[model samples]
Target: MKPRSLVSQSPTSLKLTTGCEALDACLRGGFPCNSLTEIVAESGCGKTQLCLQLSLRAQLPISNGGLNGSSLYLHSELPFPFRRLHQLSKSFHLSNPNIYADHNDNPCDHVFVQNVHSVDHLLDVMPKIDSFVKSSRTRLPLKLIVLDSVAALFRSEFENTPGDLRKRSSLFFKVSGKLKRLADRFGLVVVITNQVTDFVESSDGLSGLRIGNLRGLYSSGRRVVPALGLAWANCVNSRVFISRSGDGICEERREDDESGSSSVGRRDRRRFDIVFSPYLPASSCEFVITREGICGVG
Candidate 1:
């Protein structure tokens, strides 16, 4: 008789928190554990806020769709705004006093943060991040690892010439593959933020500009091309886009004819749209960001 096979069944389910019930439903519970997910968008589009919220949500218990683990937040361009993070944490009711008590302890002991500006620096720091995760005393599974804007590395490290583009593209692919492997080995959710470039076409029939040359050129297009182009989207399991929309102005009007003397001012509320997803239907939902956190709006 042939020897019995040793392989066992894979886990049938994985749970995660989308930071909002509606989003969780859309995601069919949450993002897959031990996988990579890309969240790409332009500035002021709630990308960082979503990441911060997810980091807090990861601390919740497994039954609540969280990983019951810690998080690692890597910053590429801007340092983390502690004040904003604190405010958001308060809004979400996720503040932990104990984690703040020990000021001298390594930040990786629970929630870790690292600042890396260049691709070379990020490559150098990867081993250190692995070491920190391995040395945690609590043995709390690291549920989330976030790279706040991965495109910054490429933009800063590589030139725009064809040779440099090819070289950088290959490097990014290799690095992304390594990250995927790391997530699988550690059973952690890896979230990467990416910046986008505009796909412009001039009237003369030119094949779009290679690079824009103007003030605020980087913010012209939605941050999807860099995040989702060149097989990058295929490497990750899911993608999300967040954007804001409003009337951009406020006006005053009388609420009722009876109250002739009083005028009411109406400020348009912000809107949240889910532009794309792999596991959920393509639909948009309205939400408001308030002191109570992200709440569904009619």
Candidate 2:
């Protein structure tokens, strides 16, 4: 007889709060544990901010809308934004005093960051994270893993090569499988940020009519789609997109210390669209980024 498998095969619904109320609502509680969630957005649209916020939120106990664990953040293209994470940690600590009452203990200490310069480095480091998660005996268990800008590593190496397509596709499956396995085995919420590529109409003039960069992720006459093609899309369980409004004007809320002018910052209108997901609806929500965090559009 063959040896029995050790890992659990069933899926889980337990989630970690994203820490942003509007984003959490959009995700229907939070990012689902034991699954991979992808966040795709244009530059300067708060992808890293959201990731940073989630790192802090994941540290919250289960009763307080958290996974009661720590997070692993892997960045390939950009340096980890420490200032923003610290700012958000300050706010998060103030709100959840019970969990972070100690003034000396920093919330950021719970988040483990790994910066990978190349794809091979990333592939190598991921398995080590699995090892840490499995052997971790700390009070806070490992709960989340974040890869900011997943496509950048491939886009540079692949360089629009047809042969590299197969290679890229293979790497996609391999990395995603590793993450998925870890998620199922230890119930980790995997979040990956992907870059975008302009969806070019390549019908070779067979059709006269054009649909304005029609693509699978876009809705109602849209342009540009998430990069890394279908293989990457299939690997992730959920895809949440963020885009800035044409005007890029976010609402201004009054603060006690600041005057009306000081309160009003360049708060751009951002749309959080759930392009596709098994549990989440094919819907979108409006939200803005502030010093506090992601807030409702209203």
Maximum-TM-score candidate: 2
Question: Candidate 1 — which pairs collide?
Answer: 196-223
The predictions' CA RMSDs to the true structure, in order, are: 6.8, 5.1
- Give the candidate number with the greatest lDDT: 2
Q: Report how far residue 282 has shifted in candidate 1, in Å.
A: 2.6
- Candidate 2 regions exceeding 4 Å error are 1-12, 102-104, 204-222, 248-267
lDDT of 2 by residue, 248-279 (tens): 33333433235655643434657788877888
lDDT tens readout by residue for model 1, 1-298: 8864445534434667766766666566777777777766666656677777777777766866778788888888776866667776664453444443444332234566789888888788777767766876654667788889887777776677889877877777777877787787778888888776664544964323222111112222222244435545555666665544423332324333446653322222333333344555655555555554555556
Worst 10 residues of 1 by lDDT: 211-220
How accurate locally, in lDDT, is each candidate?
Answer: 0.63, 0.78
Model 1 TM-score relative to the real fold: 0.75
Pairs of residues clashing in candidate 2: 250-267, 250-268
Prediction 2 global C-alpha lDDT: 0.78
Q: What is the lDDT of residue 232 in candidate 1?
A: 57
